[model samples]
Target: MFEKILIANRGEIACRIIRTARRMGIKTVAVFSDADANARHVRLADEAVHIGPAPARDSYLAIENIIAAAKRTDAQAIHPGYGFLSENEAFCRACAEAGIVFIGPPVEAIRAMGSKSEAKKLMEAAGVPLTPGYHGDDQSPERLLKEADAIGYPVLIKAAAGGGGKGMRRVDTREDFLAELASCQREALSAFGDAHVLIERYVVRPRHVEVQVFGDTHGTCVHLFERDCSVQRRHQKVLEEAPAPGLTGKRRGEMGRAALEAARAIKYVGAGTVEFILAPDGAFYFMEMNTRLQVEHPVTEMITGLDLVEWQLRVAAGEPLPLKQDQLAFRGHALEARIYAEDPSKGFLPSIGKLLFLSMPADGAHVRVDAGVDEGDVISPHYDPMIAKLIVWDETREKALSRMRAALADFQIAGVASNIGFLSRLVACGAFAQANLDTALIERESAVLFPPEAPPPDEVFFLAALTQILGEQGVKGCGRHDGWRLNGAFSRAMAFRCGEFENTVEATYLVEIYRFALGKRSVSARGRLTGKMIAAEFDGQHVQAVVVAACGALNIFLDGAAHKLEKLDPLDVAAEGGSGHGGLLAPMPGRIITLLVEPGEKVEKGAPLLILEAMKMEHKLTAPATGAVRAFYCVIDDQVAEGAELIDFEPETI
Candidate 1:
């Protein structure tokens, strides 16, 4: 076993590695960029090293810096926790040359499976079922189009070296093929530094099922069962589960055998995942193999009661397999939901900001939370926006689903937008609860998941009002003041902006109760503020809620959803709107990748104006209406901040 190991990644995965390392009595070293100087992983590690600037290219992906950090800390091994440098063959060789163990598969194995196209060819040779497509080394646009046409419409163009949903696009028609191909290539080069791509027949209603396979130095490889990652958006997984629901014992054993074949094919060592796309027709095709640990490995852990990180450490230390195939046993079903700093309503765009308040569900026998950021930490745009992995286990899949929904409801986040509410609705959705899952589940169930915003319940406003009243009275050092007066009860009106309209609620404090009236509706409410928590009642209905006041707004969390209501100041003048009228602002901090329209060019509504690359994904800024481009505020390759004007436009008169 290694006396010490350096984690060559940041955020939750690095923190996760450290916890297991500490338990095993191995000292852990963490490397951080400028953005992660005070990150939780840094605080948790036994030793920390300053790597480089915030940009990943200058820090996390800078292979030399990571190697040097490991050497400086006297780390016997470096664990490339999932993302950066984890599957890079060059990084593996660099570690070898530096005389430091790389806690992953061999360099030869990485080289064999690093590219999707190469991996497909290898899998085909090994008799692993493969989807029909083009994995040839044809780089010409004309060649790719021909291949797409041959493979039929609605084919998937994937970056040969891409993972995590980056550099992938599905083209449904020949008219859109070339344009989509160009966009895909650009993202691939930007993300993976490789412009090569492969074409595949996009499986319809396919369920993403991947097998967790582990190999040791003794050439012993075994499967740890499978996880269903079909609950996804934009080709990225949102929720995952182990012992994929609805798979028969025969199918499970088949997938397990196939996964072992993939591992043994490369003489693979350490932890790796063999992903497959299961068609609705009961057939499965090989997807790409992830050379390192997956983001959703926790579900596998929960089911098998195994620590995958520890397994990786042991394998990297040249230990034999922990257990043979039959000895390995799994008892129950497990589910994991990825909590991200993103807004589902805003097309799931990344939401970056400080975490003003965060309340996670308590970890117990049935639930666990693997998190990297704490309250007050910023979700910088420099890396992936995943907040945490919420995992739950139960005796059966149905119970696990029920547990997950409840756990999601217990989650609370403020400041940055989160997918907690969306996740709650998703797990409770009929299709999901019934296990009718697929890659298009999010789209198919979009109506229920992204329901139009409606006014919050009256109790929410009452709680907010009560919380404020209690706070103000506390400041005045008045305890138990029941608004006793000579003749009348003390009363005041509070105005709050809910959604788009301002609502005023009149409150009168009398005796030990408070009466609230809003328009024709009224309710008597009284509540006590206890450390950001409120135990309140409205019209004889008891309720519990959490209210957080930050960013000039009151965030009320109740019934598994967060509602933001801004308290209106009666004496304050309203600020004028239209500050960026006739302009398209950058939604987040990113670099302009392409200019789709030239200045003075006329375009129709929904026309793509330009592409902004942020958080390792591409966001297209489009024309708000039929308009002529007035000017280009930021050119291609220009780095722009969030809300910076990217283009100036003038809408045409009707």
Candidate 2:
């Protein structure tokens, strides 16, 4: 076992590795960028080192800096925790040359599976089922179009070296092939520095199922069952479960065999994931293999009673497999939901801000939270926005799903927008509960999952009003002289805003009795404030709301949704909504990666204009309407703040 190991990643994965390393009596070293100077992982590690600036290229991806940090700390091994330099074959070779153990698969294995196209070819050669696609080495656009034509429409153009769905696009027709191909290749080049791609038939109603396999230096390889990750958005897995819901014992064994074979084919060592796209008819096709630990490995751990990170350490330390195939037994069903700092209402855009108030479900044997953030941590835009992984385990799938729903409801985060509400609705949906899942599940049930909650429930406004009233009194309980008109009703109006929604709430209180109105509707209630909680009764139903005031914003936790209210004066309505300007603003704080339009260029509505790289994803900004570009404020590689104007449009000539 390594006496000291350097974790070459940040956020949750780094913390996760540190936990396992500490438990195994190994000293852990953490490397952080400027943005993560006070990050949770840094605080957890035994020792921390400053690498470079916040940008991944300057810090996390700087091979020399990471290697130097490891050497300085006298780390015997470096664990590339999933993302930054985890799957880079060059990094593996570099570590070997530096006489430091790389706690992952060997360089040859990583190189073999790094390219999706090459991996598919290798899987085909090994008798693993493959979908109809083109994995040739031709680099011409014309050649790719021809291959797409042969593969038929609705084909997937995937970056040969891509993962996390960054450089993958599905084209439904030949007419859209070239444009989509260009965009796909551009993203691939920007993300992986590899523009080469492959074409495949996009499977419809496909369920993403991946097998967890680990190999030891002793040449022993075994599969730790599978995880169903069909619940996704934008080709990224949102939630995952182990012992895939609908698979029969026979099918599970067959898939496991195939996954183990795929691992053994390349003489793979350490933790790896072999992904497959399972069709509705029980057929499955090989997807690419991830050469490092997966984000959703907790579910696998919950089911198999194993610590995959500990297994990886043992394997990397020249130990044989912990348990053989016969000894491995999956005890129960487990589910994991990825909690992210994103707004589902805003097309799931990554949200960045401080975690003003953070609360999660209690962690125990059945419930686990692998998080890299604390209550005061700031979610920077420099990396992935995942806040934590909420994992639940139970004796049955039904119980597991039920526990997940309750757990999601219990998860609370403020300041930054989150998808906790969306996730709660998703797990409780009839289709999801029934295990009828697909990659398009989120889209198919979009209406119900993202139900509009604007002009929040009357109860919400009532609670907000009560909070303001009690807050003004500076007293938790009502007193004889509480500033309320003892003779008649005392009415006070409050102007408030929550994101793009604003409302005026009027509350009239006489002692403990209160009546609140928003617009015209009024709710009669008797309420009392105790600490930060308000207990109220309306229409013979008791309701309680918890309010946490922070950073000039009142966060009301009710019905599993955090309703943020900002107090304003009635006369300030004029300054509420900003002037409508004819310009393109950066949706979030990110670096400009591509400029698709030049000044004075005429573009149609919804035309691709530029791309912003943030939260490890590339988001393309488009023209709002038909217009001519008037000016450009940002160029390629310029890091801009949120709402920074990036482009100006010429006024429409009526």
Q: Ten residues in a row with the worst lDDT in model 1?
A: 475-484
> Given candidate 2, what's the lDDT at residue 208?
96
Q: Flag regions of model 2 displaced more than 4 Å.
A: 475-481, 485-489, 498-502, 517-531, 537-541, 573-581, 593-608, 623-632, 635-638, 649-654
lDDT of 1: 0.92
Tell how far residue 90 is off in model 2, in angstroms: 1.5
Off by over 4 Å in 1: 477-487, 570-580, 600-605, 625-628, 650-654
Q: State the displacement of the C-alpha of residue 304, model 1, in Å, after optimal TM-score superposition.
A: 0.9
Error of 1 at 21 (Å): 0.6
In candidate 1, how many Å is residue 263 off? 1.3
- Cα lDDT of model 2 overall? 0.89
